[model samples]
Target: MDFLLEIIMTPAILACLKIAVIILLFAMPLGTLLTLMERKWSAMIQDRVGPNRANIGKFTGNGLLHIAADGLKSIFKEDTIPKGANGFLYLIAPFFGLIAAVAIFAIIPIAGPIGNFTFQVTDVNPGLLFIFAITSLNVYGAVLAGTSSNSKFALLGGTRASAQMISYEVFMGLALMGIFMVYGTTRVSGIVNGQNEYWFGNLVPMWGIFTQPLGFILFFTALVAETKRAPFDAPEGESEIVAGYFLEYSGMRWSAFMLAEYVSLVGVAALMTTLFFGGYHVPWLHLWENAPQWIVTILQILKFTFFTVVFCWFQIQLRWTVPKFRFDQTMGLGWKKLLPLSLVNIIVTALVILTLA
Candidate 1:
């Protein structure tokens, strides 16, 4: 019993557990709020009331409480397992979806520092590869869910999803090559630290977005495809495919897929912030450098959270603004356009950096 307890208490095991719960708890709600924001923003864009109806009885309109209402609605709904579906695989699908979504946050830097420890879950040497590896697992969930459903629409959705993910993953990783080249390290925390020094002593706050705008564009486009989101969301084409891979899932099972989608959105946005936007660095923040460490830490956390919320809002707005693409068009954009462009950008950026050096 003592040996077993020792194994359980190992640093690796405890770290894994902490990271797992942190990713799930934080990522899940961020996604849910993104869903609500999508509705609210879409309403604003179209000059219509979005979801004010989802409220507590007396108030009739509570902005944040709508999320609570949505959760309860999903929980109380009747869970239905289809007659022809593979019961075991059907149950497994949503869990895989959720797990894939939650796993990607392991390497993201959320705050500057918490005491002597970094707020990053893991300061991995191969951090960038870890992110791509975990995100690549998303395809399995979509494919398995679709194939197990035993429905024609589900199969089509799954196939489209798999193809789209594979095509985009190539360029998604390629987009970061410029970042790795410029920073000379694959460690995310190192990249953040590298940006701390100014270019001309005016607090330039050198971010990846400014140095490699094309890479940023490529990353953003590829991420949109990866998340199965608008302008690239051909796999789950609601109008044409009728809800894609999750056509047959109902109740809590279906809710899991929905949750996974939103979580993925948040994860991608957080990544974009960390990789291209200097993580939690606020412009002109050096003046407060000599301030109390605790105060500085709180300011950094606030900055990170603020940008997180802003990006979340941006994604919601983009969803409402953009329309889904044709399947062929989506694939063409990834393979024919984004991929080649990203490769060229990597080469150009490296050459420019070397010449400047």
Candidate 2:
């Protein structure tokens, strides 16, 4: 019994619990809130009222109640499987997307060390590679959903999704090669720590953005495409393919797809934070090296949260402001434009690093 208790109380077990709680309580709710925000933001852009109907005794909470109403509606709605659909894959595909999106957060550090614990799920060494591998699995969710639905539109959406994701992923990986080469390590936390350094008598940040400006642009663009958002959203082009790969889905299963999209939005923001914007490092934060650890930790968390929220808003803004690219235009940009530019960025970064060394 003592041995059992000890095992249950181990640090690894506690960390696992912490991670699970963070995902459920923090990440999940944030994704849901983002869905609401997307509606509100788009409404603001298009001059329309957004989600003001759901209420209790004239207390709608300024559209916030819609989130709860949406959740309840999905839960109570009919979950339909098409007569010709492969029921097994249709049921499981949403889980694949959600899991793939949420898993990326495991390796992402939210803040620096606090006592004997760190604010992350696990500190994997090949952190960037791990991210790429897990995110690539998300394509399978789209592919499976399309194939299993047994509809031409769904299949076309899935095929486009797979092709588009595969194309951008090549550049996404190459876009970060400059970061890995400059930082000299693939560990996420290590990259964050490296960004804490100062340059020119503590005037400028040694952040990824400073060293790899072009790379940041490429990575951010590729990331937006990877998340299947506006401008790069040809795969799910409503005008062309109806609702795309998720056309047959309804109820909670459909909600699962939306949740996955928003979660991937958050994950991409976090990755951008960790890679380019200095993670949890406050600008010139090292000046207060002797500050209390807990205070510093809280400040770091706040900074990271602020940046993530801003990026989320930015993505939502893009969705409303920009027009979706034509499928051919999307393919051409990814393959002919972004791909070549990323390759050039890598070579240029290498030469700069070698010369400076």
Candidate 3:
């Protein structure tokens, strides 16, 4: 046991373990499960049982078998590259989204810090800016996939994705400025710590949602748009653009693009929990400052996971609940409506901060 502890308890090992815990245990598994959950949940919402065909010897496992069935089907399918397509760029494009999506988890805190060890992968000072940079790279996946497909439809989808993602990026950052100001720090860990603070002598927790309600609304709207989910999913509208930027991909390559979207869906949930919610801090848990560290940590993790899953389900529900926006209408909402509102939110936050000070 001491030998195992010596191997597992080092700083380097702990960091690597945190990465595995976040990426493999949490993000990837939840993201993969969501692909099926979306279908199942949507079916339930619309009064139907979703995808139960995959079975073995009279056992269906309900709809859970479909996950493995889908994977096996994708693995056996042919991957076709378009004639005259840029082979290199087409091959690499799918990874950009997946990479960017997976990277977002690096800064998210799953539980409060425990002594020298933290629940997060990295607590960088330029926390949110790093997020912006990573998210911007996701645009390259759509653009490259569309451009290299040698098809007008794919190119159009890519173009739309580029414009929409870029536009929402501005609003997303602007919406977050309020949180940055209210928390008085850009470091995500610091922000989470700040939210543990109560207002008016413990009457209420100072979660970002309570303090910056408008900012929260704008920020979440921007997150939905940024992920190119429903309403804002004009880039991939099946009625017009078919599959959009990834129309030509097949096999696991196609799955990669899809996985990127689902993974990003999970990433968005984590970010929402970290920013708008109180992160891993349980409401009033700090009231017992002398509580055992292990119990506090467990409760914090549970609270964080609960909020993240709720947000994920909420996003999926939102996709099915709202109708898709027209491509032009989508852009207009971002520029004319959300953009201005985000700016106003930031201005109001600054003034409020000054008044309180």
Models 1 onward score TM values of: 0.92, 0.96, 0.97
- Model 2 agreement with the true structure over 79-99: per-residue lDDT tens digits: 999889999999999888899
What are the lDDT scores of the predictions, listed in order? 0.82, 0.90, 0.91
Model 1 CA deviation exceeding 4 Å by range: 1-21
lDDT, residue 345, model 2: 97
Give the range where candidate 2 is weakest over 10 consecutive residues by summed lDDT.
18-27
Best model number under lDDT: 3
How far residue 252's Cα lies from its native spot in candidate 1, in Å, is 0.9
Residue 292's lDDT within candidate 1 is 77
Write out the backbone clash pairs for model 1: none
Off by over 4 Å in 3: 1-11
RMSD per model, one decimal: 3.4, 1.9, 1.3
Q: Put down candidate 3 lDDT per residue, 1-357, tens digits, no spaces.
A: 999988988878887999898999999989889989999999999999998888988988888888888889999999899998999999999999999999999999999888878889989999999999999999999999999989899999999999999989999999999999998899999899889889889889999999999998988888888788997888898999998999999999999998999999999999999888899999988678799999999999999989999999999999989999998898898899999999998898898889989
Per-candidate clashes come to 0, 0, 0
What lDDT would candidate 2 get against the real structure? 0.90
Model 1 worst lDDT window (10 residues): 54-63
> What C-alpha lDDT, on a 0 to 100 scale, does residue 126 get in candidate 2?
84
